[model samples]
Target: MSVIEKFSLKDSLAIVTGGAGLLGKQHVEALIEAGADVIIFDINENALEETKKYFLKKYNTDVLSLKVDITNEDEILKAKEKIFKHFSKFPNILINNAAIDPKFEKNSAVNKSRLENFDARQWNLEISVGLTGAMLCSKIFGAEMAKNKRGIILNIASDLGVIAPDQRLYKQDGLKDEEQNVKPVTYSVIKHGLIGLTKYIATYWADKGVRCNAFAPGGVFNNHSDEFVNKIAQLIPMKRMANLDEYKASVVFLCSDASSYMNGATLNMDGGRSVW
Candidate 1:
């Protein structure tokens, strides 16, 4: 096939966890644009329907939206059954994009999310959804792909996964470093765990024609306070945050035959943030 043709996902099926969120929506749109049939799986019913409607109208193509709690094994299996019923096979691509990144704005009030004061329940929930959920999807949906001897599993990691969060970026006036609002530790742990999972699955399934990889994307802009945006931007070599749609091409390439030779790798699309 020609180089351009290798990027085509015509008639292939992709399951994107967290398909209703900001980044998830972009992944759904990119896969659809590549001519792949997309299945959006998320726990939010309303958002699922909204995403389905918007994409179906915008792309004018049929897509499946299922309200799935990725942390629930039973729910994931049922969703897998639905996919099998509709497509008569497992999804050719799995984008493990579901994770909780608690809004700093909401949690920063009076240092509500300081690491020493962080809630254990919240940490467990985030880890369950981000790390455990990805593993379940890989074991269940990925098993089908492994059996078929052809598929791709793309884990959505973060720049924070490769390096520690600069707590200074989150520093606010009058707050000590300990009490200052900071990125939750769970976010980093979950993302880093995903990279490890990607490498493990990539090798375990290599002979089965299934490829596994991770994409460590940088922060995407979504209307933060000017101070916050500027603070983070200064840390990045690009001197700017990524637009939500910027990662779409990377998604298409990693999920399509274009990345056929790639496996056991973590592609960092961090706009030079990690370098600094």
Candidate 2:
């Protein structure tokens, strides 16, 4: 097959958890562009519907939106059944992209989301969705793929998973490091745990032809304050935060036959942030 043809996910079914979020939406669009039918599994019902409508209208492709709380095993199983019933086959790609990334821009208040003051309840919630949820989805959805003897499991990790979050990037003008709003401990821990899970699943299912890999992406440039954006850009060797679509091509490459030989790999698309 030609190089381009090898990357085509023609007639394949892709399931994307957190399919309505910042990067998740791009994942869905990229998968559809590659000719895969997509199922969007997310907990936010409103965002899920909006994303479903947007993609359906824009791409004019098949998209199944499910209101799934990935932390719940029963919900994952039911969604799995529905997917099998709808497609009449197991999903060829599973994108474990769901995670609780609290928006620092929205909550710029000092001491909020600070590591020292991070609530235990919030910690559990974050881990549940980001880490445990991925595990459940992989166990349920990945099993079907393993049985079929062909599948791709892409875990969405973060650059923070590779290196610690520079609290200075999140520093506000008046607050000290501990008092300032900071990236939660859960985010790094969950992302790191995902990489570990990716390796374990990759090796366990290597003989079954189910390739499991983690995509460690850097910060995407959303509409943050100029101060925050510029601070982050300086930290990256590329001198800019990632554009929302930057990781799409990488996703296509990893999920398709182009990366057939890649397994148990953590592909870092962090634009050199981790290098520093």
Candidate 3:
């Protein structure tokens, strides 16, 4: 088969949580390019509608936009029902891309102190949104995929989850930026924990013909400052942050039959950052 045909997702049903975000929108677009029917799920209604219009106009394909608070089970169920009612089947691919940065709120994990101010509450919020939410979504989506006896799941993780941060790498940003680095306790801890969950579900659900995997992307240059991006780029072997196409390739692989043998695997699309 040709390269495109090998990875084609024609007629597949895809659900991409957090489809309104920068990286999420790229993912949705790539899936649509690969010929899958997509459902974009996000809590931000305005952004979701904007994404829907853009995709419809650009791709001339029907895309569903769901206003869903992923952390809430009832809300997720309602979205699922809507998806089923419209598509008439379970999603063949689920992309768990919904996550919150802990440093967004001023009172949040903004780390005013270095090696001294480690707030548990700040850490907990990261776990709630980044880790716990992914787990819950996996549970619901996996069950649905199981019932159908076929599907692919790709969970988004960070390279920081694999390796701890170095204080030296945070010099340009000062101690405050260092403290707020994504490698801080909560986000890294949860991401590491997410890998464990991915393995477990992949093994336990192997018999059901469902595959679970993770894409550990390094320093996506979305919403991060130039100094922050530059500081991070130095540590990576490739000396660059990830592009949308790189992230999209790995995501599409996890959702396609091309990666059929890759279950319980954590594909690091970090430009060799994790290797260092």
Candidate number of the best lDDT: 1
Which ranking of candidates, highest lDDT first?
1, 2, 3
User: Per model, how many backbone clashes are there?
Assistant: 0, 0, 0
lDDT of 2 by residue, 39-60 (tens): 9999898999899889879978
Error of 1 at 69 (Å): 0.5
lDDT of each: 0.90, 0.90, 0.80
Candidate 1, residues 103-218: lDDT per residue as tens digits?
64443546657777778888898999999999999999889898998899999999988999988887779766656777888988898999999999999999999999999999
Better of 1 and 2 by lDDT: 1
- Per-residue CA lDDT of model 3 for 80-150, tens digit only, reads 88988998888988888888754433334544424457676766766777777787888888898898899
Candidate 2, residue 243: the lDDT equals: 91
| Candidate 2, RMSD to the unseen true structure | 1.9
Model 1 gets an lDDT of 0.90
Tell me how candidate 2 scores on lDDT.
Answer: 0.90
